[model samples]
Target: MSLIEIILVGIGLSMDAVAVSMSNGMVYGTLPRRKWPLAPLFFGLFQGLMPLLGFFTGTLFAKYIDCYAELLILLILGFIGGKMIYDGFKGDKEKAEERVLSLKLIFFQAVATSIDAFAVGIGFCAINVNIFFASSLIAATTFILSSLSFCIGRKFGDLLGNKAEIFGGTILVILAIKAIL
Candidate 1:
């Protein structure tokens, strides 16, 4: 693919990561300034890594991975979304507000969001693109978009108040369902 096409592909791949980053911001409110990049970093890192891994994996196990990717994404996101929904409805505002962002959770989100990218990398095996360059572009795109989205989510969370978690959770569940379909 051409550079423009690669960049466009990166944008397409980053959407889910963007949404997850936004959800994190909404559910957790404004995080510490030092922790601001945590989600995006994981998102970008995994986003980049998965595709490279996929490219290397090639068609060897692409079919097998595809068979399981959707279910994995569904379970991971569904569980997290379910928990957020429960917390939102629990009527414990203090606990909700005090919720800390976990690295493990972010790791899961990154992997969940990047599964499609792995497939894309598999497709890359049939093309003439440079996997490293393409993965880097994809990672950069995810990082920039996710970073901006987190800020947007934080602002909206402030307005949405306690309902933000529910809204975020609903988005995630919808995304999970969408992934499977």
Candidate 2:
């Protein structure tokens, strides 16, 4: 994939992390500056690692699915994006005070958010893309976006929280459709 496409995919994939980071910001907005790094560090690490895990897993079956690579990418991205939009509209409010950003929470959130990327990794294998570069771009974009999301949430509250997810989802869906076409 080209760098632009990789970056777009990264942005699309990071929506879940971004939403979670925003929630974290709302919860931990009062923390001291020194402890602030914890949120981003946890988020960035997980975001970075998930794609690598996916890439390795995808590599194992790369040969078997080479012909249907683009279709697979489209399906995965579309499914993830559609789910996010559906969830956002479901209007299930997570109690702000009840949520905690513990290790387990971070790990689960990271995995949940990046599951689609794992499928994308499978597509990468089929397309013969460089796993290292794709994963690196994904990680970097996710880190930056996640960090910015936290900051934005801190400054603006949840005003844009749902909207961000919707936008991200739309982007992913569009990309998926484009890939398929």
**Which residue segments of model 1 deviate by more than 4 Å?**
none
Residue 31 lDDT in model 2?
A: 52
- Model 1 misses residue 104 by how many Å? 0.5
lDDT measured at residue 154 in model 2 versus the true structure, 0 to 100: 62
Ten contiguous residues with the weakest lDDT in model 1: 89-98
Instruction: Give lDDT tens digits, candidate 1, residues 1-181.
Output: 8999989998999999999888888988657989989999999988888889999999999999999999999999999998998999996968875799899999999999999999999999999999999999999999999999999999988998889999999989989999789
lDDT of 2 by residue, 1-181 (tens): 7889889988887876786676556544545566656666666666666667667786775555544645765676577668656755754566323334466655555655565666677667667677788888888888888888777666644455545445545655665676557
Model 1 vs truth, CA RMSD: 0.8
lDDT against true structure, model 2: 0.65
Best-matching candidate per lDDT: 1
Error of 1 at 67 (Å): 0.3
